[model samples]
Target: MSLVIGLTGGIASGKSTVVELLKKKNAVVVDADWIARQVVEPGTFAYKRIVREFGTQVVGADRKLDRTQLGRLIFGDESKRRQLNRITHPWIIFYMIRDCVMSVLMGRPFIVLDVPLLFETRRLLWLCTVTVVVVCDRDQQIDRLVRRNHLSREEALQRIDSQMPLQEKAAMAHFVLDNSGSLLALEEQVENLWQQLQCIRKQRLRYYKLFGTICFGILVGIPLCRSIATHL
Candidate 1:
C-alpha cells in the first residue's frame, strides 16, 4: 500500500519546485494539473463540454483550448469559474483516483497527489493520508509571478487573489513547506519532509502486511483446522 500525500500551493509559491525534488527521489506523483489538461484534450468529453459551455471563443485557431482566454474569462467571474470546475473536477478526480490505485497495486512507497486547488476544492482531501501546502509571503508570490510569467503586478495579483489565501491554506495543511527564502533552504525542508514520509511509508507497509496475513489466516487456516478436527 502507498501513503498518499496531497501537495498544494498557491501559484508561484514554489510548489513545482517541491514536486521536482520529490521526483528526483523517485516518488510517484499524480499531478492534477497534468491530468486536467489530459482530460480536456481536443477530442475528449471535457473538451466538448467546455466548448459547448463557453463557446468557440475559448478555443484557439488550432482547435485547442485557449487557456489564457479561458483564464481571463473565469478569473473575474466567480460563478463562471465554479461552472467550469463543475464541468471538469469530476473527470480530473476520476483519473487521479485511477492513478493512485495503480500506484498502490505497483507497491510504490508513497504517492503524491499534487493539486493547486487542494484546499479550495476540498473534494479529494479525504483520499490523502497527509496534506502538505507549500507557501511563501504573498508579496513574494506576486513578485515571483510577475518575474516568471511576465505579468504586470496587477495581473499577478489577480491570479493570486483568485485562489484561497496562502495563510489559510497553510493553516489547513498538516504540514507546511515554506519557500520564502533561498532555494537551498527550501531544499533542506523538502529533504527533511521526504525522510519523514519515508518513515511513514514503512509503517504503513508493516500494517498492510499484518492485515494481509490476518486475512489470509482467516480465509485458509480456519478451514484446515475444521477438517483436522473432523478427521480426529
Candidate 2:
C-alpha cells in the first residue's frame, strides 16, 4: 500500500508549488480539480444533472459548462453550491479512488491527493494516511490572489472569505506548510515532509508484514495443537 497524502490549501496558497516538487520526486498525484472538471464535461452524468438543476444558462455555446457563469450563480448562494456538490462530488470521488488504486497497483511509494476542498468535504479523509495543508498569512493570500487573478483587493478578500479559513484548515491538518517565505524555504519544508512520509510508509509496511506473519502462525498453530491434543 502507498502513503496517501491529502493535500489542500486556500486559494492562492503555494500548494501547486509543493505538488510540482512532489512530482519531481516521483509522487503520483490525483488532482480533484481536474477530476471535478472532467465529471462536468459536456455529456457526463454530472453535466446532465447540472443542466437539469441549474438550467441552460450555465452552458456555453460550445456545449461545455461555462464554469465562470456557474460560479457566479453559486457565489453567495449556499443552497446552490450544495446542490452542485451533490451532483459532481460522487463522480469526482469515483475517479479519484480509481486513480489511487492504479497508483498502488503500480507500486507508488506515496500518492498525493490534491483536493482544494479536502477539509471542507472531509469525505475522503478516511483514505488518507496523512493530511497536509499549505497556508500563508491572510494578507499574503489576498495579495497573491489579487495579482494572480487580476482581481481588485475587495474581490480577492471576498474570494478568500468564501471558503473555510486557512487557520481552521491548518488546525485540522496533520502537517501544515507555511508558504509565507521564499520558494527555497517552501521547497526545504516539502523535502523534509517527504522524508518523514517515507519513514511512515516503511513503518506501516513492516507492521503489515509482522501482522500477516502472526496471523499465519496462529492459523497453523491452531491445527497443530488440535492434532497433538487428539493423539495425546
Candidate 3:
C-alpha cells in the first residue's frame, strides 16, 4: 500500500516549496487545488451549481467561471464562502480520493495529498497515514503574502485570517516543517522528512503483507483442515 501523506499549510507559509522537493524525490502528488479547478471546469456539475448559486455574472465572456469575480464575492462574505465550499468541497474530495487510490494501486512508494484546507475539512485527515503542516511566524507569513500576492499588508492579513490559524494547524500536524528560516534550511528539513516517510512506508508495507498472509491462512487453511478431518 502506498503511504498517504496529507500536506497542508497557511497562505505564504512555503508549503509549495516542500511539495516541489517531494516531487523532485519522485513522490506521487495528488494536489487538491488541481482537482478543485478540474471539478469546476465549464462543463462540470460543479460549474452549473456555482452558476445557479452565484449567477451568470460570475461567468466570463469565454463562458468559463470568472474565478476573480467569484473570489471577490465569497471572500468578503462568510455565508457565501461557506455556500461555495458546500457546493465544491465534496466533488474535490471525491476526485482527490480517486486519484490517491489510483496512485496506491500503481504501487507508488508514497503519495502526497497536497491540500490547502486539510485541517478545516478534517475529514481528509483520516485518509492520511501522516499529516504534515508547513508553518512560519505570523508576521513573516503576512509579509510573504503581501509581497508574493501583491496585496497590501491589511489585505494579506485578511486573507490569512480567512483560514484557520497557522498555530492551530501546526499543533494538529503529525509533522511540522518550519519555514521561518532560509530556503536551504527548509530544503534540509524536507529532505529529512522524506527519508523518515520512506522508512514509515516500508514498515506499513510489511504490516500489510503480514496481515494479508494471516487472513489468507485463516480462510484457506481452515477449509483444508476441515477436509482432512473428514477424510480421517
Whose lDDT is greatest here?
Answer: 1
lDDT of 1 at 97: 89
lDDT of each: 0.92, 0.91, 0.91
Which ten-residue region of model 2 has the weakest summed lDDT?
68-77
lDDT of 2 at 153: 87
Estimate, for each residue in 1-232, the C-alpha lDDT of model 1 and write its tens digit: 6789999999999999999999998889999999999999999998999999999999999999999889888877889999999999999999998998899899887789999999898888988999999999888999999999887888788889999998999999888999999999999999999989888878878998999999999999999999999999
Better of 1 and 2 by TM-score: 2
The list of candidate 1 runs beyond 4 A from truth reads: 216-232
For model 1, what is the alpha-carbon lDDT of residue 142? Answer: 93
Better of 2 and 3 by TM-score: 2
TM-score of 3: 0.92
Which 10 residues in a row give candidate 3 its minimum summed lDDT? 149-158
Model 3 Cα lDDT, one tens digit per residue, 76-177: 789999999999999999989899889988988779999999999986887899999999999999989888878778777767888999899989898999
Model 1's C-alpha root-mean-square deviation from the true structure amounts to 2.0
